[model samples]
Each structure stands twice: as structure tokens, then as C-alpha cells.
Target: DAGITQSPRHKVTETGTPVTLRCHQTENHRYMYWYRQDPGHGLRLIHYSYGVKDTDKGEVSDGYSVSRSKTEDFLLTLESATSSQTSVYFCAIRQGIGQPQHFGDGTRLSIL
Candidate 1:
């Protein structure tokens, strides 16, 4: 949605390091999501939150963690950066199931 924003649109980190990315929304949507996109593989969900403090792992949950302490914010953390984790990460929000989800501009992460 127009109210959703992802911070530090770009980042570079070394392998084995920890990195955290933030997503902030003003729309007050109950559903928020984190996804990663890589060439050829398309988009993959990393994690999602149904509401404040309620989050679940997705298809690529390994090495990644997420937290949502308030309705307007969600955080994605990479426990240990890896070269394979380098990709464009995106944050999305929707009012409810079946509703169109709007996405924020992706964060491009590079692990050296």
C-alpha cells in the first residue's frame, strides 16, 4: 500500500554477519509479508505476520527470522549472512485474505 515502506533499500554485508531489515507501514493492515526474489527462481516467501506478535515461517524460513511488535512495523533479520542469501527482499501488506497485497520497493542485499 502507499503507506508501506522498507528501509535501507540497499545493503552489503560479509558472510556470517547478521543483518536486519525493517518494514514500516502506516496503513494499519493486519497482514504483512516478507519475500525474496532472485533471478530465474522468481519470488519466494520468507515469512509473514497475521497480526501484531503473530508470525509464521514460510518456504525459505531457514537462516531468516521475523518479528512484529506493532501493527505498523515488521523486521526481518538474517541470522547469518550467506552469499546464497543475496537477493532483493520485499515487504507487502494487505487488508485481508483475497485482497490485493501492495508491495514496497525491494531491498537489494549483497553478501560478500
Candidate 2:
């Protein structure tokens, strides 16, 4: 089983507010992923890291950014969150792309 934790399980913020969500892993996995889930849209990748200090943008990376200074932690930041960004954000990690992913409880971010 994969062990992960996402902070601020739920949040309410105003439009244009700055927000940061954190993902922590205890398994010391090499690949970490950030995704946002919305109704009908399914899950869309935002950013991912292959290793510490080596991160890459994913399909839906716009309006979002990511950082990984340590192997066990990955951070996703919204410089200016808008209502369009409101959704459930999930964090995942794995050994490889084809490998199974373990997910966090998710952060329900709402921008009003």
C-alpha cells in the first residue's frame, strides 16, 4: 500500500486569493503527481515530479505551479486562485507511470 497525506482537506477562499496545498509521502517514492478532479472532467494532471528538484508540468498545468525540495514532500501553489480553479485536488505517487498510484484524501478548494 502507498502512504500519502494532503493538507487542508477542505478550504474556502476568495477569488484571486493565494493558496498552497501540500502532499506528503511516507513511502519515499520517486514519482509524485498532482491532479484536479471535477465532475464530468475526470482527473487531470497538473504537475509531477520524478525526483527531488526535478519536476515537470502536466496536461492541465496552467494557473498552477509545483515544487519539490525534498523526496517526501511536494507542494502545489496557486499564485492567484479563481473560481475556475475550485475543485478537489488529489496527490498521488508511484514508482512509474504504468504502476498503480496511491491517492490522498484530497483537498476540496472552493474559490468564491
Candidate 3:
């Protein structure tokens, strides 16, 4: 999957806390995206970056933030963790438009 890796594959945290998930890639893709996968909602985009320091909000970005300081790393942070925010987060990287994205396994987060 183009050497994509998500850190802390599993995480359990309490409500009202802050949590951060990391996605790192070795392929030097110019576009990266963060998505949350829930049982019924399917994959919902949270945020995305087109290039270094250039990011935008997505469909489900209410409580989440993302940063891409370098070509190989993207960070997704939950401002304040909540039960509804618990889900499997996936990171995707694409070389450019019209190309297929390679995804990391995912980060399973639980909020109690």
C-alpha cells in the first residue's frame, strides 16, 4: 500500500480527552486524506491535504483537525474525544487526481 502506516493501531481513551492519530507514508504522495469508517455511515472524509501545510475540512470534520507538515506524514487530532468519535480511522495517499489511493490499515479508537 505504498508503505503507509498508521500509529497506535488500537487506542482506548476516555471522553472529553484529546487524541491524535498519525499516518506516515514512504511514497511521497502529494495528496493525503483522513477518513472515519463506522458501521452504517461507511467511510466519511474528515480532512485532507493537497500539499505541505495546505489542508481543508471534509464531510465529517466537526471535531477533528489535520496537519501535513511534510510530504510523508499526516496527523489527525480530535479536539475533544467523545463516544461518537470512536471509529476506525483510515489514511489514504494518492499521487494526483484520477489516481487510486493507497490506504493504511486503520486506527481503531474507542472512547469511553
Best by TM-score: 3
C-alpha lDDT (0 to 100) for residue 26 of candidate 1:
92
Query: What TM-score would candidate 2 get against the native?
Result: 0.95
> Which regions of candidate 2 fall more than 4 Å away from where they truly are?
none
Number of clashing residue pairs in every model? 0, 0, 0
Tell me the spans in candidate 3 whose CA falls farther than 4 Å from its real position.
Answer: none
- lDDT (10s digit) by residue, model 3, range 1-112: 4799999899999999999999999998899999999999999999999999999999999999998889999999998999999899999999999999989999999999
Candidate 1's residue-wise lDDT over 3-112, tens digit each?
Answer: 97898999999999999999999998999999999999888999999999999999999999999999999999998899999999999999998999899998999999
RMSD values, in order shown: 0.8, 1.1, 0.7
Ranking by TM-score: 3, 1, 2
TM-score, per-candidate, Cα-based: 0.97, 0.95, 0.97
Whole-model lDDT per candidate: 0.95, 0.95, 0.95
The stretch of ten residues in a row with the least summed lDDT in candidate 1 is: 1-10
- Between the candidate structures 1 and 2, which one is better when assessed by TM-score? 1
Give the better candidate number (1 or 3) by TM-score. 3
Model 2 clashing residue pairs (backbone): none
Clashing pairs in 3: none
Worst 10 residues of 3 by lDDT: 1-10
Candidate 1: residue 13 Cα off by (Å): 0.8
- Check candidate 1 and list the clashing pairs: none
